[model samples]
Target: MSGQKACCHGPGYGTPLDAMKNGPREKLLYTVTVQPNLDEPHGDYLATVDVDPESPTYCQVIHRTFTNRTGDELHHSGWNACSSCYYIDDNAKQIPKRDKLILPSINSDFIYILDVITDPRKPTICKIIDGDVLKNHDVTAPHTTHCLADGNIMISTLGDAKGNAKGDFILFDTKNFDCVGTWTKGERKALCGYDFWYQPYFDVMVSTEWGAPRMFRRGFREEDLDDMTQYGCRLNFYKWSTHTLYQTIDLGTEGTAPLEVRFMHDPKRPEGYVGACMYSNIYYFKKKPDSDDFEAKKVIDIPAKLISVNGEKPKALNGMISDILLSLDDKYLYVNNWLHGDVRQYDITHPENPRLTGQVFLGGAICSDLKNVEVLEDKELKARPEPRYVKGRRLEAGPQMMQLSLDGKRLYISSSLYSPWDKQFYPKMIEKGGHIVQIDVDVVNGGMRLNEDFLVDFGKEPYGPTIPHEMRYPGGDCTSDIWLANDGK
Candidate 1:
């Protein structure tokens, strides 16, 4: 199989040669950008590009390859492009040929599965698992799909009304991509949105519901908006085998619209913690070994003073927490504030009580007065004074996804909001282009800092203003799954 050639179907997967030669390597990190244009024919958010360790440039197509446990080549295939426009090149030139070959029409509620060849040189898509084909099917919106440690696949579905089905979790046979079992959220009122992060090592999986159960109650006329108090983000926990909901933590009342939750563990610390970011605050949870559940420990409220360049406070930094990397020693936790325009590092040496030791401002503080371009427009407006200038370093655009090397030496960051669904709202916010930034991080005097000299720009590619959603390495799948591939022995 190693010597066999493969064809392309979606984005290919590649492993670092160093990891293969060493032993169990670090888990490859992947960030997925959902590109959905509501004005487009099909309004479903679809995966556009991928970022990984192999490329200096952040953008890459879905079709690619990855080596199996036996080191054999495997192909990845993708299906269902809602709005079928190919990504544009950096020069604004469209890849007309590739666009013509691939279908451009967006398929409503259609889910696409990707299978890539292991060999990089001849990678191709081997199969495409369609959502409609699954039993008790509903309208398809590709939510989150991840490969479990035991070689099984877990996919969350965004229920579609046309399909007359509610959102549920579907288990699949990884080798054959066959649907084996299904876990339904039942006829619950809440709308289960896309993507879930699985921690196979801990035998725990976490998922988020964009709108709380109360929202569904209102939609069903069971409750009125004035009576709806439980309508924000929800963090659900399930046991690995039965997918049973063992515990749930409701982020407070101020409409914290939690999007993504991340768990971080340090070999040095006996207790670990999970971090969740919503529309409001960034919450941290600590896992207790004695009990099967985790406890909500701390919440970092986003200061309302942080302003955007437009002179208005951002509605909400709605997107997955995007990327969270624990330092090699697990002493510091680095997190990218997707829409808040900052990368924050927390001192988690004491997992039970994590503290914010340091932070770097990027893309402008979410509360800066300079963001108010509207106020700036009024030459006669003197009531609201402009913010004083500060010179450190700022990310030109919001970083949607990020990747860190196993050794914790290199950091890759990609820009591009998943419009409408994530943030920015497509077509209307198309003025903003996408870019990838590479940074070098250094640990000094017990603190981590971004090395300014190592920035790399991925804006020269021809993939038409890319919006990088995720970044990974070797053979791992999503951001939460990143780990030592083989245990760098």
Candidate 2:
């Protein structure tokens, strides 16, 4: 595939080298962004871009490889480490042994093992796991995936085959790519499954859940909240070594739809964070100094700022913090407000007291209709886009599927939050597809600036519109790196 702004279809994939390796060099190679066809049965794919500004095709999607299957709602992805506690290869190829991105399907029990090494330009789906095998354990709908110390692919399941909310985990052996036994314990099952992050330093792992398969399979409804089975509000902690269920911290009602879990970068640190969508909260969690137990408290709350009229409420108040990314240095936190149409950067020097340093609004449902401006820290930012159907009300979309750079200076942004919600909230995304926008971070001061020149508009593709999701670089991402305390030996 030539370095054209347009996406190459049907094996137009070129050589898979880190386009950044040329000219002024950077640590990462190309950026692999996930793009799923949200409408009908067109399938999903990964769009590889030359993020290196020095490259001739900077910001252009150089390659694309599709899954060939559709309606799967391809979601999050991560590399399968050879060892549980070993560091990932610095300049190694994204293939088996070195690393293969294990991607899970949200609607079906299918997991794709992608081989980026065989052909960087056209990554091959080297292997696929039938999640139907998990049906024996009543497991289906796999969500978040992480590598264990022994290199097995650990996954969180959202529900059973019958669509019953039974949050648990399933595993796949890295050697054979076979589905293993369950990862969660029977005594401490969750209400539903969403996202998780593990810390080898503290020997602790934490997981969060959203609604059951039924509720999330479709756009959210106000009436669904009344049913206790539809949502979750707790954080589950597990012992990293044993996979034993540790203490579970209940956030009560305010913690509805707890998702996107993140831990501080340093192994020495015992704390991390979780983002709650329905209630619009980010909770900081830490291991108790007195014991191995864990505790989480809400550190930031995003209020409902998008009212359609002066006195009436908007269609949705889910200041849904759908995607979140922490800086490599652990000094800053960046989160997206999908329903509110904004992305915020916060300084977290003091984990308990984060200072909001910057914010940028893209588009939102209610706010776009009102077109109002908000003044924060002497800088006036519109809470909702005014005249242009500003806030995103007309577009009904905002930033989502966030990915931060190795240096944390460039935060890649996507607009697709969820399969069912993208259409209802961001209707045009179905016909026009999604987008990829980069936000330049003033790391020293905790501020943000949108990169006007960089835009990977999926809607503009020749194959119709495609919804972009979670993304990763060939190397150096918070999710891909794991520090093993004993692996130093």
Candidate 3:
């Protein structure tokens, strides 16, 4: 399909490569910025940034649109429609365009829908899904949002209406943005939910676990690991068509708090990786060769660094593998160590054995040579590689969220993780505000370098210091777009 013809349908491109080759170049990006402090009641907002280097406002936030209320802690955002539901027949008229964006608040449980097509530079709030509405459907703490192939929307909620640690998926009609009740048929077997991905060809859907909202929203407590009800360390597999849980895999001690999950872009492949935050490990999973079961193995392990904490000497600090994603071509994998303050790229051509190819430091607590580090309730001394700088601005807060370009040439990253966790890990960075930077990819040779020419410092915004979370492009990005088996035709 020609690029021009593909743009007329939902999310356009028929395959990941097609999108990378023919998809439109990103000129603007919409990122969610949160006001972590409650005393300053200004509220979280969506920021519009000019990414076009040729523009006069290049590398600057051009506009900001706030959510309905304060203390929302806006986390992730996605489109209402994507290539998952590309129109194949005359029903193309009935299929919605890749326009509106669904932004969900992890703290307040509110979902804000924005009209991006109207003005890509400045998105306006078209509709807001109140927390009460989700509570009525027995779910809250809305997290990951993904467009379904059936012309509807599905979001993974961290808990039930009261936010008490139960994985329940909430559905909504894309056309009207109305709540369509829970996607789980009956009792949800999973204890927690954070990120999820589906592959219709395999008839499988995989989801990872996080902490209960009631506990996580307050802050991170090391003692919570002992309580099964407060934290989780398992992955749930479900039948995609029926949305029924069939199997559950316990990741044990080394896989505590499994967060992000990603499958290969190829529709026919059934392999992916999940990053375990607590233990700093990545597990690769795939279907059993001759059976109807799936198996996972620990393929990447990040060793802990010893640091002083609150006058105590020699304490092990986990890397806190916060986010992970695959390149559009599935040839490389990127991992972000929030606490260690570095991003590492791996060559995943062999799937099980991921070879570290490139690594670069941005902002992190342990990545510096300073003797004293000030985070909440801890004083540490570290002697590691000096932190890297861009355009004379010292990058603070380690890399958190990432979004890669379709063509696999550039990778964009944000620094803020979660507000509460950010307070515990990098409190000083919170006051200084979050930032967005670009990394030029060595796609051919497997490496990455900081694009010193580009930087979006949220600290400089007129709306006070804010922490930016997830980001999405006006025309679909590598993370937000998915292609079906028959989409290429």
Candidate 4:
């Protein structure tokens, strides 16, 4: 990957800081790093890093970097090679070390601040925040972070405490990285799990939580089998100024288990819509003009059985709907059924009622690799389980993360298990290798699907690992809302 020149221009080329500081000023490049579990050897935690795009070939690729409230730099480096830790000096020599800071557990929600760094090159350890701040606050384990339009940072906390499982939102001073204030949704313990995304166009942030009442029940055991009751998902609207919860909609009522919320601005739709995955249904909520509320207008139920390639009833589908994406043209919506191992496209000609127009199955009889491992001795474990097989269909691995090309012409799909912290905790699943399916999108056919022409073998890389969390488009416009400097220049 080193010899290939990045598609975008080299960093630090056109920025105003070109002549300011000493050598080249470093820009934060976020890349998710998976830290393999030494105990089970299969589970790993995903962490992010900031790298200087123009640094010499020999500079160390970073593990983590963040600035405290006081503007002090904090950094974490030096994980083992199996963990994919490496150095890139001017000579590009690969030196490996095990001294890197390893978190106490593999769950994604275990730590508050995993690692931080102020300087991209030669980063230093800054400060670690305590988790006690969430004792009675009903905040979740790991906080979802987003750098706001202002200099402040917004973190969404999922409430998994002894009380109600409902969640809250917190804001921090980016300069010092201190908790400034929080946005609570009344007094009910709401379960706001996983993540929240900001929709700047509407001046509001949106999040979805799987409302499971049993999660709040005492003595809840992992092995307990119970009816999965949908508590109804939430679409929270916040007033950016006061950091207050302005309005919310019960998304799960329209669709079961509304997990992911994505914002879309369409030229045809009077009000933009939020697409959500509710079990076997797809829902869309359109925003009210100049208001913090949305009208739940449309719900589309996916057909249970597609005429299989050989024309048979599709198998039972179970699992969380991981991600939903809209093409640049806003004509179609792509939904990934993680457990079902299928990616489908829907036509949104009528924004309120999208129709499932296309579908493709990449796997069958899905079983999580993380849930299959049995911890024998401290340093050893059993071989990962193979895909579950069923008549006329074999389980394909789950699709965990996906991203579209800027032009929206191609889709990149990845198959990996959930973070090690989830119920199933297989760590080394990535070592068995995963598949990257690239599909062409038909923009002309109301966002219909084109044939998949390429499948990249990521496992063949020299130090290949199990999971690849994100893809970085180097030298792009850097317009992501997380970037503090995105003026669209």
Candidate 5:
């Protein structure tokens, strides 16, 4: 925190942006972060948090409200293309005036639009594209959402009408919030779609897959492993300008369940990283010079956390690398292993190589790490009869979703992935409840320090224990913000 700025930073927030400003431009104060709760029986909505590091209640939940219909598990979220409006010493065309978030539930058919502009403190649901919108589009289970250069909210679906993972994307108008149409134009088919990132400068976008919606909906099962069609293992590239399929690269067996996709913050940089969940690998891809072809290389593999059943090792390592995010400077890469129970930071200045600089285990499938620590008496954590880590505060669930401040000072962690899976993997998450921990990052030196004082216990909510997943901060965060036009030429 010495030379770095205390404020939140990103492509358009604290940095001297180049794109013109819109709406109430008061230096874009207030760090409003939002995440979805995956509760059943009419209990899911975006959870808003105040993450302004300078404020007194920096990591406190300022406000929260329920959105989707009954049984819809709220998941991933992204901004409404407002990021393209800022420029840094370079004049770039400003995006259409919009200050809302496009949130979609992967388990349900609806998409909820959260308007954070009217009242930063109290975010309200402005509109919702009912399940019927998805029905008409012949797609189901909306997953990752990204803002396009033309201000269209590009949402990738998990299944088709018949529930195959041959998913597609839908577009929404940011100005008035209307379902434009299915983004898929040509017969370009994606076997499965989980997460995608686009670079307008390269006129290219890449997508990775998890599996068929039907398989993942019920959580991880032994049947999924035996069934070949259950999970997806392909990465697809698209010609952004035309929405045409550029190339499809089968990641083979190693890149199973590739979840989150992230590109370098610098639009000109073609390299990026994606988290492979099931196999527990990190695949980084780069564009082949002078051509549209791209290649994905396995750069990192997380050590598997295996369990012994009846004095024998289980077949697979339970290390689920669910979420990965890059710092605004694109020098640091942060990822959380939901199953292994640790969040690790890697220095990625060299695209081919990533150096692990920091790591912390919160407690997960294996408990051998802890045998004598005193358990913490807290609203969110439950101490087992037998101890695990010395801290005694073992996470009831693995780290699910994560969001980093624009300036790369703080990284917020949550522990809910899917409603069904949350129960399957971390059953205690519902009873003990999920928690959000704020970790301080030394951007210049490369390290992480858990800020114990800054913790948000989702289990302590008035509405019973609710699990939290996929969070986004207003203005811009590592995952949500997108650019439309570039530096004014």
Candidate 6:
């Protein structure tokens, strides 16, 4: 914290718009990368990449910090404080800065607190709250980590200690990272939980479901989709102040696996969007007029493609929209289709109708073996596009996770979804490892093109083949932040 400029707001730019206009450009990226298999001798770790173009080590992973345990399966990471705490009365003293990161293991139930204040580039582990601690609270399989308006941190838990589908929220102190008990007030009503978003101004919180730990730990099975007990297809809405589930909207089969939920960047607006991974669709949700609760409608749908490999019978493959995020300015929404190998940019100036402005393919099942594969869409035969190559190397794996720069000029993407899912859908990714690529965004015109010169190949690291997951910038980013101020403030 010596050289870092002090912020008047709690820990981030005052508002999403302020962040877009005033936030400094990112010089380094902190990424979570896991080994090829779950049984690695060395555990999953955080890899720091140099993003500054002028730096000598630009586009290279300069540092790696490994966790103590071997099989943690580290996923979505969050900060201890952000712009959301702007309204805290004593925020200047209670939340001095946003230096600590809360990283949770979806498999082991362990939580690691990392201190980046000493050095943002090379963060060291300050504390590790073991798996049993969370089990003691009757919650395991921690997924999303978020900081509330107060100094406390709230995380969404996917299952009970026995590995059953029990959706609950866990709370912990910001200073000690000690268990403050479950956040939900009464009995757990949600069948399962995955991702969540909150808007305090409207007193609303929306969470999506994604089955239990036992159902998806090993790998994804097609039969699991048919079993209601194994997979989830509903969205749960909660009262933000009371921490109680108020309503649930069943998306049916077409909206199975509603994974990531995102509210608009404007804190005043209650409208948002969710990505359904299994069904290949995006559903828009908003507060019903003259009501406190909400309703959801399907706004975008991607047709599944028929794929055949090695002269086998054609199989229908879903696009598998793994991740989505809105630009800080909230003018465009970006979505990635993991199976179809395409990242699409949609202009959402009108919240109800999204217009497609740009699209690009990386690599996926359809592009796995271009020469020997047959691809069809709807009822007509279609030719698969040639494989994408960057820096003379063929790009493998589809875009699974994405991070947009605060300025909305550059988009960063990682190719690995989860270790188990990576092995099932793209086995080659396990052998060669996942990679991170950069896509230059045309902010003025709303289009995207691959930046061929910038690439971070995890397969070439000192450690054996590893897969990169989620990413965050040292300063706040588009996906990891929420603003409490209204637009045009």
**Model 3 lDDT per residue over 316-399, tens place:** 777799899998889999999888788899999999999999888887876544457423222222446577677887778888
Candidate 4 segments exceeding 4 Å error: 1-138, 160-164, 185-194, 199-203, 211-232, 252-254, 265-278, 288-292, 303-316, 355-358, 366-396, 420-435, 446-465, 470-489
Model 5, position 233: C-alpha lDDT score: 78
Q: Model 6: what TM-score?
A: 0.95
Report how far residue 178 has shifted in candidate 6, in Å: 0.3
lDDT of each: 0.41, 0.69, 0.84, 0.42, 0.69, 0.85
Worst ten in a row by lDDT for model 5 = 1-10
TM-score against truth, every candidate: 0.63, 0.85, 0.94, 0.59, 0.85, 0.95
Return whichever of 4 and 5 wins on lDDT: 5
lDDT tens digits, residue span 1-489, model 1: 011122211121222222223323332333333332233322221233334445544344443222111101011112221011112123322221111001111123233333222433233334444435643454343445554433345566444434222335666664456667666443332334434555444556666654332243223222322332333345667665556667767655443445544554321222333334443355666567777677664445444332234545633333235445565456666666665455666676665555776555445223344333332222222344322111222344544555555555556666553433333322322333344455555544333454554333322223333244545443332242323222210
Better of 1 and 6 by TM-score: 6
RMSD (CA, Å), candidate 3 to true, equals 3.3
Among the numbered candidates, top lDDT falls to 6
> In terms of TM-score, which candidate is strongest?
6
Give residue 317's error in model 2 in angstroms.
Answer: 2.5
Residue range 100-176, candidate 4, lDDT tens digits? 12121112223223332232233333445555554435454443454443434555554545433455665655445
Candidate 5: regions farther than 4 A off: 1-42, 53-58, 85-95, 227-230, 309-313, 369-394, 484-489
Residue 446 CA error for candidate 5 (Å)?
Answer: 1.3
User: Model 2 segments beyond 4 Å from truth?
Assistant: 1-42, 82-96, 309-316, 367-383, 386-396, 486-489
RMSD in angstroms, all models?
11.8, 7.8, 3.3, 12.9, 6.9, 3.1
Q: Candidate 3 clashing pairs?
A: none
